[model samples]
Target: MQTAQLHMTMTGASEPRTARVWLHRYATLSAFCTLVLICAGALVTSNDAGLSIPDWPLSYGRLVPPLIGGIRYEWTHRLIAGTVGCLTLGLAVWLQFADPRRWMRRLGITAVGLVVAQATLGGLTVLFFQPPWVSTAHACLAQAFFCVMVSMAVFTTPEWGSRAGIRFSGARTTEKLAMTVVAAVFLQLLVGAGYRHKGLGMNWHLAGAVIVTGFVFWTVVRALRYNATESGVAPAAIALGACLLGQLFLGGGSLGAKLYYADAPQPMPIFVYVTTVHVALGALTLASAVVLALLLFRSEAQR
Candidate 1:
């Protein structure tokens, strides 16, 4: 044990108490950057600004472009994406060296890989003139990347590694139900992405919304009921519920705005704002479900 500790210290482990807090903050910032990236992507789509720069990995052969018209949105989105990619890379490397858990190191690597793939897909979406499939895939991948960041955030917490395992009755059943809710939310996001990009999956998206909403409602109730025993359940459940309600309101506003401006010569600002917010809220909902599910499972496991 002394030799292992010596190796860990020499290999840049640093002080655990301070390093853990820094890791948590790093993960949180990565998640926030990802959220901003999602909003920027949404704005690009809602405003029909995807092709504003007409270049991939560059804007008109320059790293920076004049912030004008659609170029502002597109360039700013690219900047945010680049920043997120860098942050994820740093977090992954930091986890590999500083975090003791092998699984967490692997997750960090996976996040880096996903960020690279996501960036490639974003470029392809532009190079291909925003093909429906590519763009939809890009959108879906953004949510996946966001989920990864959220997981990293959760795992970095002191409680995650040190909490005493307290098994409650029906723990397995609760985990399974939470898993269902997470899956439903992800599927609904994918369907919604398709519908947003190509109008090809609105019916499916609507059906999925119903299913996801039901599962979310079920999950929230279970969490609340389990709150008497599990201290972690209530907060996560409340966050998920709030996100769901916001998503519902944003969805309605998006639809209403679209219909109200269906005959306009140009897309109205309100429509753009509503649709972007809807997309952003959808990402948040998925992240919340993912975090809640992971917390439930983590809480149930015997540490």
Candidate 2:
């Protein structure tokens, strides 16, 4: 036995079965809650609701705001963010003080780090007026950290983690291809973020989702060409394809609005709504890539 495992065995008294069950339950709930928090923030951007409050850590100079009218979206997003922050903070405490596995303890620490990093990114977004790189990185990190949280949950749960034997020898060729598609999709997401922040390319952004369309098409093509039919990577490929189609319509709608305003008596409408949806979905593309990467990593670990 490994030294750590040996030590654990030697010194350990039995943990109450019920206690372990509760811990597993808590981790499972925490993971799902964290995922919901992630989607809430995504919608904040999707609806151009970030600046609705026009302040950080407070909405309209208050910690809590009336949730009537459009403030509802912004305020609700904030409330959910606060709740998520607290839940993760609680999860970290539980892991540190209660969880016995050495690796899980480290993962809890990593989760804490991710929370801190995410908060800092949020602050930078506010202070810097939502710079594209910072915002996109902030957004991408949330999704990445969500996956990490999911992994932690997976490791902690009894029915999930203990039985899934590691496979270190598997379809090496397919695994590498899946990994490659994920990397390309991640790059495409970053590029799409850059495009969203482009001040001069409003029209092109609307018309130019063709770029990502081709990328997703390529990703799907490759996934079909390589991965096992039963693997999770195929769904990610399908998601990329779906998101790309949505991008085309959202991009065109945004650009169409811009051109329409250019001809109207009123000022040009803000492109943020369309832009942010594209931006948020772009994050989704990155996340789908991340999941595919996880599948590849799983395959490699098993081998």
Candidate 3:
């Protein structure tokens, strides 16, 4: 009888562990899908296909329009967006029932809300003929949603829960700097989006880039120097640094592509490709900074 009881106890304990692992995997999947959706959106914008279908929630008044020219980019973006929405809804429902953390559940709901808003903004962009301000807002919100998805992935990681408390000198300063870096990166994204949509000038975007670069490096150096031994801190800082370097290179390439293609009748394919990759890399950079900030804040909270 005691053997059976022991077996049942072990089985019950293992069940939740398995479920947590699956939950984390699902969260990670949702985050990856979100990133892909962002890339699709960038492709549409870069190709000037935002209004190729001239309809909302459908293409050419059908479930699927003929994939030709700009229609293909626009339609693909819409389809990917639909997939992301479903994934996010599933993630939220799973977290609501399976996760024991109340805050995480709330975050899941918030993710659902953000996705809904993002979809609405997307539809508005199409319906309104892609107004610059609306498009810029849509782009900005997508980045925010991406960050939220990333946070969910991080929160669900087993290490997040099991992290041993470690004392890091100047943690408060590091956390504050990390927060500033996140804000700076986000603002840079805003400026870049505005420039892409013709709501702002390239000069402004360039200026924001310089400011963000300084902030990112400063934060990275501080975190690596002071919290290098901390489990999450060093990795997050390193990731942030690596993303910054890639973003800078992509930014320069995108600028060159645009200048070279400025006189072309339509956007050159190279220009489109470079700008699309730049947008995607920009999203990754913002996500990296966000992850770093979240880690810093988490460490601070644990104290």
Candidates 1 and 2: which is better by TM-score?
A: 1
RMSD of each: 3.3, 5.6, 4.1
**Shift of residue 231 alpha carbon in model 3, Å:** 1.3
lDDT of 1 at 248: 84
Task: State every prediction's TM-score relative to the real structure.
Answer: 0.92, 0.66, 0.92
lDDT of each: 0.84, 0.62, 0.86
Cα miss at 266, model 3 (Å)? 1.9
Q: In candidate 1, which residue pairs get closer than 3 Å at backbone N, Cα or C atoms, i.e. clash?
A: none
Q: Residue-wise lDDT of candidate 1 within 1-303, one digit each (tens)?
A: 544643553454656656777889999999999999999999998889999988888899999888999898899999999999999999999987777777788999999999999999999999999898899899999999999999899888766755424354566766778888888888898888889889475789878878888889888888888642564677888888899989888888888898899899876899999998888888888888887777787667653
* Tens digits of lDDT, candidate 2, 1-303: 344442443344344334445766777677677666665665566555666666776677788886765567668766776676777777778777666566777888888788788878876777678887787787667766766776666556543333344453454655555556555655555454455444234444433355546655765676666664635667766876777677667666766765666566432325545655655565555556555556655645644
**Predicted structure with the largest lDDT when compared to the true one:** 3
